[model samples]
Target: MSGYAYVTAEGLKKLRAEVEQLERIERPSISRQIGEAIDKGDLSENAEYDAAKEAQGLLEAKISRLRGILANSRIIDETKIDTSKVQMMNKVTIKNQKNGAVMTYTLVSETEADFKQGKLSINTPIAKGLMGKLVGDVVEIQVPNGLIPFEIVDISL
Candidate 1:
């Protein structure tokens, strides 16, 4: 929350779009709902009004959080990324030493991580262990289950 979050230009654009949607569209819609609910009945007996107020609060909190993230975000230039070793935004191919299973993952910021797309958050234990490691290097990382060793196969931008 304090330090800068590294994000790609596309990720930053997505975040900005989300914030805009929440503020420009969702906020006014919630306000209209609150106004309609207020017209329904007494303050103490109105469930709709209460629900609308709660929803407004939650939406405001989300907007605040997203704004904070944007304030601290730093966009990473893809052209400046180094592929010599494991690093943020690098697509890394690794093999599980114990089972010989190979997998590839792109190390990315937490907001940009999509497991379905094979993007791993840099904060994850595996990505943390892989940081700064070169291809052919063997690394042992501790996970919830136990320690597992992985051999770095390749690194690419």
Candidate 2:
């Protein structure tokens, strides 16, 4: 959680691709914008130049941050994942005790989480509460609104 970001091979590849796109495409585009602004002259009050420089700085910072994340990332081996209990990378099906609504979510690293895709970050309150819980276990998770009870229906890889 502090020093390393656990991710799947596909997640790692996606992160790497984002970094490449930033460096190869965005960097050059920002440089071109800056050059064009410079050719327009008047350095004392050049809003375009200033904006382009700021954008470049932000892009560089993003690239650096992403590289650091990549450096500290550890890919999780899917083959070794145990499905006996709830844990990272496990697809868990839970039923809302109050409304009887059923939902399935895959527990994944923070970097790989996409709510729309049914991928929940392990850091989330629900995931944290479900961690290490076996199928048929009931858990109560505290969210911003209140505490909600859920029954573990199934857990799989």
What's each prediction's TM-score?
A: 0.94, 0.93
What digit string (tens of lDDT, one per residue) describes model 1 on residues 21-46? 99999999999999999888798989
Cα lDDT listed for each candidate: 0.96, 0.96
TM-score of 1: 0.94
For all candidates, the clash counts are 0, 0
Q: What's the lDDT for candidate 1?
A: 0.96
Top candidate (TM-score): 1
Give the local distance difference test score of model 2: 0.96
RMSD to the hidden true structure, all candidates: 1.2, 1.4
